[model samples]
Target: MAVVGLPPMGCLPIVITLNSPHGLKQRGCLDSYSSVARNYNKILQNELQFMHNSLAMFGARISYVDIYEPLMEMIQGPKKFGFDKIFNGCCGTGYLETSFLCNPLSYTCPDATKYMFWDSIHPTEKTYYYLFKNTLPILDFLLKD
Candidate 1:
């Protein structure tokens, strides 16, 4: 018989590194009650600071990609498409319409093709396209060099 050993936990450190704060938030995550949630942003920020410092220690070039500005611009300011889309999603009912409630049983919006959010948590295909078009510059900046 052959004996098996567990794989080394290489992901634990990377998990800590990635979870450190970038100040970004997902919908409904703001209302979470976990203690980790309270300090999540700070932890993430600190983690990024640590990474930046570590990179500097090794004399590696680092750059920041700020996609938030363009994403916000698309959401608030005028754009070439879906000028009237503001609230409500193309899937589910009320606020929790995401996959949780919007799947299999709940009522979905009549016309998904014309809505911004597909569910509460995800953007509709059309919305994604619009956002993608506007975010090209940021994407280019990140992919450059």
Candidate 2:
């Protein structure tokens, strides 16, 4: 048997970001829409919370960060943050997000600086920079001894 060394919690950054369009669309009310997606997200959240708790129980120090709530809040009240569009991604031009592939010939935003999404499933560098900037507080907490 071999023993593996685990990195110190303070030295590692653990990030969990949730992006569930179906889940957000089905927020609140039992029957708004997409019962399956809603149920899946609920189950997933519970499972993730359970995992976090269990890991902590085993003396594995960890930090739980929620990128979902903040992003959701921004989406719900975009005007408060100077963002006008939330639903439409800045890249791609197809019915099913099939056109947002990261290729040289793929259609992209004219100016990624002005948009939130760089592709169908991911944010632009500017968006990532914004996220990182806002994440300083969380990082500080995690880095603290």
Each candidate's lDDT (Cα)? 0.44, 0.45
How far off is residue 61 in model 1, in Å? 6.7
Q: Ten consecutive residues with minimal summed lDDT in candidate 1?
A: 1-10
Candidate 2 lDDT over residue span 54-124, tens digit each: 88666543444444444555555666655554444565641124232656877766766555455544545
lDDT of 1: 0.44
Best by TM-score: 2
Clashing pairs in 2: none
Off by over 4 Å in 2: 1-60, 98-100
Report the lDDT of model 2 for residue 28. Answer: 22
- In the range 55-110, model 1's lDDT, one tens digit per residue, is 76765433333323333444555344553443345655424455566777778766
Clashes of each: 3, 0
Pairs that clash in candidate 1: 20-44, 21-44, 21-45
Indicate the worst ten consecutive residues by lDDT in candidate 2: 8-17
Give stretches of model 1 more than 4 Å off.
1-67, 77-80
